[model samples]
Target chain A: MSSGLALISIFVLAVFVGFEVVSKVSSTLHTPLMSGANAIHGVILVGAIIVASHSDNTLQLTLSLLAIVLATINMVGGFVVTDRMLEMFKVKKKPASSDTSGEVK
Target chain B: MSRDLYDLIGLVAAICFILALKGLSHPKTARRGNLIGAAGATIATLVVFFYGDQLPLKNLPLILGAIVVGLVIGVPAARKVQLTQMPQLVALFNGVGGGAAALVAIVEYLKLGEEAAEKAGAIGAAVLIATIFTVVVGTTSFTGSIVTFLKLQELMTTRPVIFPGGRFVIAGNLVAILVCSGWVYSAADTTSVMVLMGLSALFGILFVLPVGGADVPIVISLLNAFTGLTVAASGYVLEATLLIVAGTLVGASGTILTRLMAEAMGRSLFGTLFGAFTATATAAGTADTRPVKSGSAEDVAILLNYARRVVIVPGFGLAVAQAQHTVRELADLLTAKGIDVAYGIHPVAGRMPGHMNVLLAEANVPYDQLVEMDEINPTFPQTDVSIVIGANDVVNPAAKTTPGCPIYGMPILDVQQSGNIIFLKRSMRPGFAGIENELLYDPKTTLLFGDAKASLTKVVSALKSL
Candidate 1:
């Protein structure tokens, strides 16, 4: 197998495992997980953009630019929204009270 | 321009992904971790676009158009969905990822041509694997998630909708899927592979149908894992760095979640899948025809006000009626009159574990006031009133000693220990597991049958007048 082909094959197989995994997360964590995963999707954007910048072909260039912007938004927006929601879990610190878990310790 | 830059970006992206995952374990830094990871991913994608020579750049509008379409749907969906609805939304999004991966793989395969399919043997293997995974999981998630959404939203019954020959249908679909998967594994023709994908899609739908609403969390988790795998496969087909990392992180996290969900229900992953239909069969021993001892809300409120110590137990009905804030107000008013008020939270209360606690916490209920089932159960006898709000299963006494009861072995809140029990509900409805709550008809129990929000509000108003 060619090195390039091997890389692609590994990538494809990894995705197969990826699908099976995401379908099984706990409900308590979906929002947080999605927010985190969306940021990771930016890696795709960065890679696509990098490919486009160096490519002489118009197709690669356009795909890369488009991927970059979408990836950025998905990543950034996901985080912002997730953070806002997580705030609901945050315990506002009381003076001289340092309880984090808020479980009555 | 240098190769080192791309490598550096990839390394950074990996680190970000790891840190984000770690941060996600704890709620505090999870959002920041998610953002940082996303940034790293964006950088990684940019680096790859610059360095990768294989990216197709010809269809300029196509790429932009896809992004635009994603935005139009994604933005509104994210904005409008409530936190409670996040699970289904995530399922929908994950399905989209798998579908996208499958589409990308198919496009790539067609582009490579019949001549290259054999010439680029290893590439063909990758494409075949990625395309097959993406299509199967994507189609499954799309259908299964829609079903889950319907169940959660009450558009469909929570009961196990068993058909006369459900198992045979599912078995047949599974066999066909296995044969198709085996053929796809051998690098079959693109058209035939696509046809196989259709069979897998049908299989996914049948696989989820027998599963009752009680197992939705597990189903959702499994579907999420499928989506991650599909995205990773798409990454392989596209040869993109971002897709690979993103897919791996999602895949890893999703797998962990599936394992956790199985654990939450005290079952193994395969056990849950193979015997998922058992939840329906288990419904046979449940109490469905039990009657509730109904009372007026005003009378129940008066009784609660007269009590010296009152414990409030909130359930899915409270969440469904959006009554947390009202219940909180009731607690405060009772407290003002020298009543010791506390909330009894069952472990497996509501749709998910700790769901009641989350809702109560959202209403600013003091942590000290919220007691777990174990601690509060023993204290129930000392309490004067135990008020159940939109709850059924957790208070049922059948879970204790009634071996034939469906929830026999499961621990429940000891509302039965209270001298006076008031249950606030909209109707004499059974819980998600379709089990009758024996406590509802107990001699000590008085059901204030009404919508949780209105009932709680009325109770608060009555307490205020006192």
Candidate 2:
């Protein structure tokens, strides 16, 4: 099969997958959801690396390096920020040593 | 790595991205999901170093240096960013990602010289289409996100900046973009591609300028989707499988979220895009002139102690004051006394969706005590005291009773139905949307004028004495 055809098929199928995975998220988690999705698109860093490595001129190297730096920021910052946000939502477990009423409710 | 082996790694990375998003759907798995996504990114980044065609030796230092620089800036910024400024942070990060995608398209175009242009006619139309799409969408997302960052940070006016013939100017930009796209399809040169990117960027700034401050959440979500599509376009150009899947996933999900945000505000997507909520002229002259009762912290405490049940409505003001901890303490005190205490959270309460919930969760408030607007609205009639903290528009009765009001038809917490309403606000200044809240003017509601943290602390102290 042609590379274009393969890409098109993957693109169409991924759209459904994206919708299915995100639709199950509750409203209370929308902020984290946005952050997570933001990080996923940071995959562009791969493309930046590719173009930057092959750059033969100063202009090409500069543009691609800028892309690399920006893409790295998007990837690293997006995931770290998302993780920080999601960590706050974890359900707290009571300490085993506490004898008093430590019930969450 | 060989080409086939590289393809295998890409496939595995794509699956990891899918699993990451799946894990994020539930709070219990969200943190783990984020880690999984990061792992996927790490794998993809590693694979780039092993590309068989590009030896990777020449750019190895540059790539590593760039990664280190990004970590230096992104990590500290993300860690230190206040929860209140999360929207701006997200905008900044998202903008950089879009800028990266646009740069990729530009470098690709510049690399394709006159010799390659003549040979490119046989490479298939898909590549050309993807290149054009990447440049247009990517540049638009880049400029649009920067403007959004400025607006959210208050460095620029949050109000809409519409001028005469604005629509025509935006329309002209779009038409020029179409012409440029056609030009690239035929000529396939760097100049045409640059022109396309510049025009799209201009349109992006104009596109977001007309949106009001209160409606920024929807705009942010929309731009998030745009960045995703741009990445997907670049994925097509690079023939990278993981980018295509992950990008499409983000694009679809962000679009859905943007639409849902508009609906949560009781506005259609069309209305949100064109009829932005706060055009200064339209919302003017709807002054709510009427007598209102005022109360002290002691009075509010007395009312709360005697009340059978109490519901608290938390809004952006609570987050701004960083009073979630105090509010949670107050609720704990009320709950221990056997007086019912529950929170009412509006869908669009804070600067971003679910922002209020995240703030309360950070305070260790039991999730069960936090009730959504739909589920809590009916219970208001049975409550004795409804304490509204730093909230205005979400509890305003004008949304329901006033016909011509700007926020009419937007669903709000039914605080007015309760026997007594106590509002904690700095003054009678209208909400972000600049609509005068009629609920504050109602006789049943009493205003408590003070900072939310100080006011809530006083109320907690007064309740303790009783």
Top candidate on DockQ is 2
Best by lDDT: 2
Off by over 4 Å in 2: A93-105, B114-124, B277-281, B284-289, B402-406
What are the per-residue Cα lDDT tens digits for candidate 1 across B1-466? 5667765766677667767766665656665666666566555644543554444444445455655655665666666666555545555555544444444444444444444665864445656666667667756765776677677677887766677777888888878877887776665566666777688667766777666565666777677666666666666666654466567667767677667655654456664565545444553444456555788767887898788888888888888898888888888787777687888887656765545655666778776677777678888888889898888877777667665444555567888888899988777767776777677778898988789999888777776776
State how far residue B341 of model 2 sits from its true place (Å).
1.1
Candidate 1 residues A1-105, lDDT tens each? 975666656555554544443454444454466545643543434333333344344543444444444443444444544554555557553343343221221
Can you tell me the CAPRI class of model 2? medium
RMSD of each: 5.3, 3.2
Candidate 1: which stretches are off by over 4 Å?
Answer: A1-81, A91-105, B1-3, B45-49, B54-56, B114-127, B182-190, B237-242, B267-271, B276-280, B283-291, B354-358, B371-378, B397-411
True contacts kept of 2: 0.74
For each candidate, what TM-score against the reference? 0.81, 0.93
